[model samples]
Target: MKTNPVIETLLSHRSIRKFKDQPLTEEQIQLLVESAQAASTSSFTQSYSIIGVDDPEIKKQLRIISANNQFYVEHNGFFFVFVADQYRNQLIGRDHHEDTSVLDTTQRLIVALGDASFAAQNMAVAAESIGLGICYIGSILNDINKTSELLQLPDHVYPLFGMAVGYPDQDPEKKPRLPHDVVYHRNHYNPQPSRDALDAYDQAVRRYYETRTGGTREETWTGQIARGLGNPYRKALKPFLEKQHLGLR
Candidate 1:
């Protein structure tokens, strides 16, 4: 199929870890936010917020909380915290003397999360189109409680993920995704995908990692899944979510 610029940009996506020592202009920041705001929202609720962090002290605090990758945070770029927020709606309900109980349910939480994710992807794509590389920081969930406290997050608001965007210092190949057949089903659900296809993907993943890391981390997708899922991760997030009045239907 013939592709357009947008499709080409999407296809060339990569998670950039290293970044050059440069700051994004205010215009770029505004454009990124505008792009994010243009994403589809659930019921037009716009149940999301973005916090751009530039202070070194705050970045240090976030770096400590994120635990794994701190490269971009330590450098100069735009670090945005995408927040899944329903707090505004809660307040709106209070002003209207309306019941805000529905906002505390799991369904509403899902909506808010989807809103935040869509906004983040829009910002990411826009940033990439402007020659900025980006990486998502999910390790912040390692200490979501502390992160909330540090950010002074109110009830009905949760930090979904952080993104670091800057000029690319390193060029990396686009990571492989699952095959179209495996991911895209026409109508009915296909629970049993071809084992051969999965095995081939595993090999492809292994080769990608090996070549990327100079053979130091030659691991298959299955191996990564096993390791990543082997231990309990963010198990405390359930209580955290309840404390934030989310995921509690």
Candidate 2:
């Protein structure tokens, strides 16, 4: 397959859960943020904020909030929480005596989420390009209220996700992804995916887990999805958003 430097960097992506004891230089952090800022935003809203966590106590609290298993949250060279933010925009609107009710709409919330996700991906790619490793921590939502209070996030600002970046202490193998035919379609959507392709990909994922875990754990992609969706997780997410004065519509 043809590959360029950017493509190679993307294909080599792995979630680094372990990191060396070194911390990132201020210059590196600035570059990462600049890369994230360069990401496209909806209607130029730029509805996002990046919070860098450097306080040890705060990191410890966040580690606990993240289930206390992901030590990388506290041990990484740098940690960032990408926030879906419209609070700043709302403040601007208030100062201009304009109605800010639109900021609370679901459409605005989705826009902010998309903006944050795009920025996070840009930062992830930039980190990889600079020979650094990164991992996204979605468990930050496990205790949404606590996370919000911990970060002192205001209304119209939600902690979308957290990322840990650092020099890698381990190099794990890349997990297999869904086959192209299963995900890609022509001009129209494909209601029926290729079962054969899905089965092959499941087997590949099972093999990956087995190899990575020394044959002790073998799970397929479908199985993982089933387990994840079998029970409702973060049932308070909607209420939390409502409390934050977002996603009302």
lDDT of 2: 0.95
Return model 1's CA RMSD, one decimal: 1.1
Candidate 1 lDDT by residue in tens digits, 95-134: 9999999998889999999999999999999999989999
Off by over 4 Å in 1: none
What do the candidate models score in CA lDDT, each in turn? 0.90, 0.95
Candidate 1 clashes between residue pairs 3 or more apart in a chain or in different chains: none
| Candidate 2 residue-wise lDDT, 22-92, digit = tens | 99999999999999999999999999999999999988889998987889999999999999999999999
In candidate 2, which residue ranges exceed 4 Å CA deviation?
A: none
Residue 24 in candidate 1 has what lDDT?
93
Each prediction's TM-score against the native?
Answer: 0.97, 0.98
Can you give the lDDT of residue 246 in candidate 2?
A: 92
